[model samples]
Target: MIKTTRIPKLYVYQKVIIVFAALIIPVYFVNLLMNMKGQSFIKQEFSDSIQSKAQFYSNQLDDQISFIRNQQLQVVNDSDLQKLNFLSGTLDVFEEIQLVNRVKERLSTIQNSSDYLLNTGVYMKSFGRTISTQSGINKLPNQEYEIIGKLYSNSNKSSIYYQGGRLFFIEAANNSSVIVYLELSVKKLEKTLDQLVGNYGYSGAFITNEDFSYYISSKHDDSIVRKIQDNVSVEQSNKNDDSHILKFGDQSYRITYNHISTLGLSLYSYMNQNELTGSLKTFNIWLLVMSLVSVVIIIVFSFSVKLMIHNPLKELIAAFRTLETDNLDILIRPKNDIEFGYLYRSFDKMIDKLRQSIRQNYEQKMALQHSELKQLQSQIKPHFLYNGFFNIYMMCKAKDYETVATLAQKLGSYYQFVTRSGADEVPFDMEYRHAMDYVEIQRIRFSNRIHVVAGEIPDACKHLMVPRLILQPIIENTFEHAFENERKGGNIHITVTYEKKSLYICVEDDGNKLTDERLQALQKKLANCSIVLEKTGIINVCRRIQLEYGKPSGVFVSRSEHGGLKAEVIIHFNYGGGSDV
Candidate 1:
């Protein structure tokens, strides 16, 4: 009787429910996560829209500043203004007044055409005179002169600079002949900025000079501007795009900043986050309802699968459990469900047929067991007889009478031992003699090139039973494969020994053919007997011995002491204390 390992029992319905739970639990969590993630994505899109609006406002302000800078450049680069050379002192007072009037006319033309500029003027330090777009006598206030004088010393050909909270566009003549200034109105730009972003969400835009003196925007609160400035420094410097987020007074604002390099001004816009993601609560409620409905559907699907698949499978498995215990009398009744009805009927018919075939199968197994030895004998006998007869024919053709007679007699004795029909086991001495006959025949064929040596077997182990022809194929394998052209001294030695009720028969050769790796591989193959044993005659012999002695007995190969192949057989048996069994 064989003890079988028990399988952990599980019901089909329980397994199906377990699989459903495994699938549904992850889907439930994933659905909830997708709901949350979808809401987050919606919020992100809304925030991105706000940022886009902020960017739009920044671009509008940049355009306005660019327009103003272009106007200033046109006035600064006026060809008429460039031609006025004030260095010549030869002009009289009338000529000087004429020069100043001509400059004023050009300034008035510039100021009238530009909508953003409040006034355009030039202050001449070389003559200590100030000229404006106005047509009066060219006199200016002392306080105004003081401010313009300060601007004259520090201004360049760039955009308008702000000083004392007032906008001024100042440009010096190429020859330092005059410093041009355009005083811009902050109030007007503030109104324009309001109009630009007034229709958008809680949004405001501003333009500021680098010195923080002059600024124009819809709102004047410094906190929001400071937040924008602080966050923009980190975000805009690392990223080329001009959008960022700022938190001020428990409110979040998406701020965008754009730098107009031509005018040296920074444009900024701010928008509130609350206005962007306001409808998220409604979306979340809808997501919750959808998630609940999905869970209900999953529960219903799990129960439906249990009724449709699990119950029928459970009944089929219960019927098949009888086969596990060698009880084929059990039958599977046909199911009412069409899916399993045919399967159940077929299974019942199979069990009935299996019961009727049991006795016939037992008789067939007995016949197979009786034929296995005959098959083994048949596999080796014909091939061996053909080779033996061919060798005798060669000896006779060579007219070697002594060798022919000796080989013919040995061949007859070898076949007689191999063809013995009833017994599969032979005594150690008979097996050795059968192996020696084959080896001696080969020795005669090879003549002086081969040497064969047989050691004395122990008397106590002589009659111990071993599988037939086990040793002869091993000895024959050496002559067939192990010898090479380089090996002039081909030596074969057979030895038998006994220890602790186990017999070891080793056949070795000095052909120097078995390398260490080859020896290890052959030994491993013999040890792992799961392979097909029909490849070599020696392997078939090894598998036969293992099968006879309940798998603890088999042939093994190793490196010989003479630096060649060594084949070994380890067989375990009970000895009657110094007596042959």
Candidate 2:
């Protein structure tokens, strides 16, 4: 026995519930899309907010630096400042002192203009004199003069440069060999750094020179400054003031930087990313909770729909599957709404009518087929009996006792087989025995003028039950027509073979009496489905076999290999022990 894999069965209700569950997936997909889009927007807005702070601090520093440079420009053009630098080595002490006092007053007015300006002074290289404000009319130390001395060598126009760990503005007085220097207040710049970071936790801001050689930060922690120095690059910050997110240690920070062109430095600020986007996290948590609740509600509602709708339709679908197995006895009760109840009752009534119609149809067909067999069998008996009696009478007139006795014996045995008390269908062995008896009687009647080539049925095919007398009429027709008008060289060949699931009873002769055209006409007649005919011949035998075995079992008539008609009665049957009864 071959084992078959059985598929797991799902009812209509369960499948519908699965479809309902599938509908919930897009809601989750939409939530994912929302979070993705929301995160991008939050990061962009946070970057913009921090960038604005960076720009705000940068503008303030630029404005203050510009004003100080403008004041230095004003002081460089003053007459007292000019004469003091040009003729300092030639002046009397009292006269030089008064002129220096007047220049000191002008410098004092410029220094007091901004809170971030710590000091302002001018150094004259031609007179070897340093002028006052912080230290009036004194020759300063060489280290202090190194910045003004070396910075003025490469600059004449008012320009800003970073040097000696401080920011300065240097400008040379035209043709006067005088240089001015201004220093920014470190403590006040630190205050600006504090405002740049605002109120953000885990945040800081810094100012670094273009060379990255020195820096000032809101928190003067050296480790963090070094960490920022090691991990971050501030090179492109001078080109544009864009914001970035950077990770340092275990924390992520949103960093913003801008180049201060006036000061020749870049300003950097940072805040923790979590602190910047904390509100978005809260919004996502609430959204997830709400979406989960909606999913649960959908699942509960789908089960309820299964109970009200899918359950009713599930029964209808089950009834149809049962019908596929030819089981029409399934009962569906009217326990649902009127629409479903009406359908259930209709199915019940339809099954009852279907069963009744099948019963009537089957009985009528069986009775009619049995009657057709009996009538065909009866029709064969009378015509063959008349021929047998006529041949015996002619032999009696000729007084051929031996041949008549043999023919009579075969004729009697043929009748006994036709009159056998059993079903109209009999085994192949019995049918073959009956056909041989008829062939023997005809052999004796034709004597030396004819020869019959034949053999017994194969042992494998001896037990297939077939319609009675299916072979006799074909042989009888071969004799009555093929051997008519005394055609010589008469030979008859009968063969029984089994192939596939069918038995072939072929009776061929060499009489040459039937033309190819006549054989064609007979083949078409034999294949015709209308089998009820008033003749006991080749067509009749074909009809009986078709009625018994249905499709693929019929008489096929063709020109035989021996140049005569070949009548083949093919019957299909199943192979089993003792054949199909």
Candidate 3:
């Protein structure tokens, strides 16, 4: 029986919910997406209809305005009006009076012909006199007279003006200084605007030119009108006639604007947003209710399944609990459920034998792994001793007593650290200091040929209890193998840093002469989880880190930024006891 680690996976009930959700979620979202798309189409169609209606009304008003303007033109050139103006001095007061009455009759006839017309006025420039159908034959220099004269000059050939809350059209005579002005019925224009927005729950419509000098409207809600003016920009309607939506007072509005080229004004049609999408909103609510029903069904089905499987699953859990207590000899009798009975019967045969084999195998395997880890850690004694004594012999032969003294001190301290027993983990600062001692020994041996750049241990990580002999072996491997053939420019650097619950140690070298294939092979050795069986110092350190911390906490090797080998060691403090280091 092989001992394997158990990773908690999804349970059957969880899978059931996931499967049902997977089946229902697409239909839910598909219906939602369809509703969204349909709302878009419906709004577009509604906007198109309003756009066409606006255009139709604008053209109709344009034709009416043009007809009124034409009638005013005809009266300007009428023979009776010409006599009333240039020939008024030659006629007697009675004859002039008859001419005035005749012109008044013509104006009255024109004003009464159209429902949109208000009143017409004739300015008699030659005598400073004016005549009108509303206030017939008023004397010269009156308020209406002065207003007509001012309006005639300020019309600026634009043919129209607004004053005193009324829209007016002014046309001058062809052969005289006389002018004829027409006042359009603002009330009538307001009625047209009102008709455009008839019966809306909350709505308004209005007509405005570039001047906005006169906004003809049926309602007097200034706030809504001002909001519409600010939010709706109709300058782009010549290119695309898409209507816009506006939010006001907890209500959304659909606003449409169409430019009237003939009258030089724009008509804006406003209505409640829900007025157009009431049906779709109802449909969306229905879909939401149905989707909730589906979720409720799924939840109810999950409870039903739990109830159906609860007893059998309880029995199976009890059986597993007996195994948990190492009571594998406690056999579970078959239950009434056929499938569960089959499982119980099958497991009963294997439980006892499996229990005995697993206990023996697990104990042996753990003992072998722990023994291998200890051997790797303690193997530092023999190889390091041989090297230390040989280096001391070389210094003695060179007659360098000063160098010999320094080497002896470093060697004694380095061995004193490695030869200690019982403590498998030491403070990180101790490990760091011991690793430095090994580097100092190498420094004395190689003299000016090796430059080891090392950083101080961070204060926060100094108290961490880490596995013994972890950092020294990697540094030794670097010095022994990487700088083996190099005589100059040999460099070694070690660093320490921590993130969250993890400690990172990186050792790098610049004197490495490793080929790509050999480097790759070495990297693969460090990454492999199985015991390497090879007793190389770097590989042993890699295995030791893996044994202490679990997966994803180990040694990794890559090419360094300095064109050499870089080895990184990662240990998780959660697994490697934080208090112990």
The residue-by-residue lDDT of candidate 1 on 1-581, one tens digit each, is 99999998876667776777788778878877887898789878866765676567556656665666566567567654544444435567776667666777877776876666787777555555666764333544455666877766666645556776577767666665666777777777788777655565677888876545556776745777776666655765565766666778788876766666655777776767776666667777876787788778877877887887788887888888878899887877774758788789878877775676575564563354345556656766465577778888887899988888998999888778877786666788898889888887777666658888887789988888766777887887888777635447578888889988888889888886667887777777777654664545666667666655546777887778887888888777642111237
What local lDDT score does residue 269 receive in model 3, on the 0 to 100 scale? 75
Superposed model 1: Cα runs more than 4 Å off: 1-10, 24-79, 82-168, 172-200, 209-214, 218-245, 256-265, 274-294, 318-337, 359-581
Clashes in model 2: which pairs? none
Candidate 3 lDDT over 1-581, as tens digits, reads 99999987866766777798898889889988898898999988877777677778888888888888888989989899988778868889999878887898889988987888888988877856788877777777787867777776666676777777777888886554788888889999898888777777677888887655577788746787778666544535343644667788888877777766645677877877787677778888888899889889999988876765655677788888888986756787885657778777767866864776586664664565566657765676575677777888987998988888988998889878877666677899999999999999888767658888888878888988877888888888788778866777588888899878788999998865867998899987887845566865778777767766666777888888877888888888665323533
Q: Which TM-score value belongs to model 1?
A: 0.44
lDDT of 2 by residue, 300-394 (tens): 87787787768788778889799889998788889856787988897898788679859776466557667767776667556667878988999
> RMSD (Cα, Å) of candidate 1?
19.1
Distance from true location, Cα of 1 in model 3, Å: 13
User: Candidate 3 has which clashing residue pairs, if any?
Assistant: 464-581, 465-580, 465-581, 466-581
Candidate 3 Cα outliers beyond 4 Å, as residue runs: 1-34, 92-102, 154-157, 174-176, 211-214, 220-242, 245-253, 272-279, 293-581
Relative to the unseen true structure, what is the Cα RMSD of model 2? 23.3
Model 2 CA deviation exceeding 4 Å by range: 1-20, 87-105, 122-179, 231-245, 306-581
